[model samples]
Target: MIKVLGDSHDKEMYDLLVEVTDLRKFVEEELHVLWKDVDEVRVECQSRHASNGNASISTSYIVVGTHGIKVPKPNMYNNTRNATMVENFLFGLEQYYEALGIVDDGAKIANASNFLHESTQLW
Candidate 1:
């Protein structure tokens, strides 16, 4: 799903935030655990706005199903889910950088950052 991120850099950053937020939710919900109390998770998203107005963002997520649990490689037949996650992440990064030239208003930066931070509180 392609979204119009922003007129400039802020828009691109906003999109990355949205993508990370979606991916986090999908993993938490779709990949349910047998015992919720037995697991811990960490999600990190890095976002920046360029001075030239083209900044990109990236997110890394790790889930520990149990104490020191390792993530299993997806089976060959189920690559769709993995592809979706990758697509979402890359799309967000691209849109964010694309906005650099378009994000001219200073106030947009504050608003963009606030929205992204609030929306993607995956920590």
Candidate 2:
């Protein structure tokens, strides 16, 4: 884990990334309880070089209240700071949850188990 300092917007961005991680962890745990059928629900944060090799999306989660970006392929010689990467990453994550129809309200938590079951269904 890398440590960031300073109170600039960059720091704010880093904070946002931390928040994203927390949210992912929370959701993953909820999934565990909500969907008892499966014991393992892996929420991965992947960061790799892009085909073209520009900047990479190192962050994979963020707060739903703000812009949530997802993971992007890493770029070579990209000057993007970690904080900026994290903020954009949150935006991506938000998009992912929206696509998955994941509601922030606690109402859906109970149905998480069913959600998982349906997600893996071949039919």
The best candidate by TM-score is: 2
> Which candidate wins on lDDT?
2
Q: What is the C-alpha lDDT profile of model 2 across 28-103, one tens digit per residue? A: 9998787764423322211222332333222222234334445332222223448876566445554545655454
Instruction: Determine which window of 10 residues in candidate 2 has minimal summed lDDT.
Output: 41-50
lDDT of 1 by residue, 16-96 (tens): 999999999988876676344334321112222222333322121122224443433222221234787656644554344
The global C-alpha lDDT for each of the candidates, from Candidate 1 onward, is: 0.42, 0.46
Worst 10 residues of 1 by lDDT: 41-50
TM-score of 1: 0.22
lDDT at 102, model 1: 26
Q: Which portions of model 1 show Cα errors greater than 4 Å? A: 1-7, 33-123
What TM-score would each prediction reach against the true structure? 0.22, 0.25
